[model samples]
Target: MFLIRTLHKWFGLVLGVQFLLWALSGAVMALLDHHKVSGEHALLPVAGLQAPAELLPLARVAQAIGQPIQKLQLKPLHDTYVYEATTPQGVKILDAVTGAPMAIDAAKARELAVGRWSGSEPPASVSYISRHTLETRDLPLPIWRVEFADKERHALLVSATTGEVMAAKNDTWRLWDIAWMLHIMDYDDRQSFNHPLIITLGTGAAWLALSGLILLFRSFRRSDVAWVLDGAEALRRRGR
Candidate 1:
């Protein structure tokens, strides 16, 4: 019994901090509005606009890029109508009216991000990101990160190819992310919870629960059962 109790005490000490963090993180996530955390409120939706009266032909686009086109789309990149061409090399954008090739550079990325921003302030900073990160996880690489000069530090991610606002994030989301990291027990990537540390800790927690349940039963003494035993004897006497 003493051995079991000692083990239980040590386990509680080890897991207590993690349990408290779980509770706190859960509370924060619950209190936060889903819309704000997702940055949906910071970015505007793409509204449909009227297209140009005349568009350049597909032959002109082929001649300009000199690549075999797998697929093509005529769509609005903000106000400018452009043809998105999927070539063997990669995606190529060309002005639909003039058939001139268009590149999605840092300047163009800023335009796309700012155009989608719903806030009053223009972007505080804009940078081209070609690698994956905690902010850009699961999203396609080679994107543009646009940050706004606001209290929330509202940021927007724009696609390098299509000039679309792929994702939005803010200070609220960053705070919630810390809570999530603690809750999931994934301190590094904060993306996946199915790692070895969590699995080991989960196993320990399960053992603590099972051992605590056993201790519950073993904690009771013979005196605690005396009343029930006496009552049964009284019933037997009455029967006799």
Candidate 2:
């Protein structure tokens, strides 16, 4: 029993940071109710179509953009189109039809952010600014949906038509996003365990858990066999 407990404690101390990170990430994944980033109200009235407009031929647009299209989505209600395609660095977008830049208004996106911590508001940790549009003319489709990681580590969705802002959910889903990030110790894409302080704290948590598990296992030995068996049966029943 003593040996098991010691082993568990030492193991925890060694991998504490990783365990904490896992816990935090798991919690964030669980409590995230609305994973939307909010921003200034989208450019209003995206001119919903009664009938879809004859969109520019996606193939020609793709050639113009210099990349192959992966997917396309149109929102006539907002007179917008979104495309997803590949990029050298990762994925980026293009404005093939309307010639509008795929940029979003940061001030507007910020306005949509919530500041509470009830797992229902936008993230409250850091203020967000608009990201520049990553435009390319090398795609096989007229429109592209660009994938972006915001300064806040939120995934951004952009429109490729009319340069109009479509729906900004993450900037709006403010508080909830923060909780998840905090839970996982991922400040942003670059700041999770990548940060020294966060790494240390995460390690501490992992060690704590490992020690606890070891203690529990150690207690299951010798005269405690009946207790351990009962506990195992309980766990089995729960699993069933």
Candidate 3:
């Protein structure tokens, strides 16, 4: 009993701050608007665009790829139709109309970002980030980041490899990220929540709760509730 109380006190001291952080972070996250955190709203409407009535033959697409095609997708890249082919050399985007090979250069990345953006504000800046950032955390590397001058600080991440607008970011997402970092106890990349430090903290927290419950049950004695028991016996005799 003494040891359990001592351990509970120590664990409470160690995990007290973390517990508070978890509570505060959880509250903040719940308050945040999920729709604003993600950038699906920035996507341009594809209602008018329709699939091509006639697609180029697979042989033609394979020939333009110049490699053994492992997989292929016939999708619309904005208004233009293209075939995204996966090969040993990686994904190759070829024009479905002419079967010409296409490359997603820095210029093209910016162009695609603009095409996907639904805002009236022009692009403030475009930079190719080959490394990870808070906005591009856990996403595939080498994305083109496009920032807009809107009041929300709307930002877009376009895949440098595939020319696809992978993610959208804004001030709301930035604000929520801080809470997520604290909630997950992931200070570095803020990508994973299942690390050792968090696990240990979680275990310690659980132990604190369970120990408290055990101590509570053990702390009570029959004498403490004897009066209530006696009153109940008197009531039964009176009923008889």
Q: Estimate every model's Cα lDDT from 0 to 1.
A: 0.88, 0.45, 0.87
Summarize candidate 2's per-residue lDDT along 1-240 as a digit string, tens digits.
676566666766666655666677666656654434243332233344454355556675566457555554443323335444454533444444553335434432332222111123343332322343222122222232322344433332333322333334444355554555565566654225457756676566566677687677755666658788889889999999
Greater lDDT among 1 and 2 belongs to: 1
Candidate number of the best lDDT: 1
Model 3: colliding residue pairs: none
Candidate 2 ranges beyond 4 A from true positions = 1-4, 10-32, 35-46, 50-162, 170-172, 183-185, 190-222, 225-240
Writing each residue's lDDT as its tens digit, candidate 1 over 1-240 gives 898899999999999888898899999999999999999988788868799898897788788778888999999898789999898888988999999888888899898888888999988999888988778886887899999999999989988877878999898999999889998989878988889988988898998999999999998887999999999999999999
lDDT-best of 1 and 3: 1
In model 3, the runs with Cα more than 4 Å from the true position are 50-59, 221-227
| Pairwise TM-score winner, candidates 2 and 3 | 3
Question: Clash number for every model?
Answer: 0, 49, 0
Error of 3 at 4 (Å): 3.0
Give the local distance difference test score of model 2: 0.45
Candidate ranking under TM-score, highest first, comes to 1, 3, 2
Give the C-alpha miss distance for residue 98 in model 3, angstroms.
2.8
Worst 10 residues of 1 by lDDT: 57-66
Residue 66 in candidate 2, Cα distance off native in Å: 17
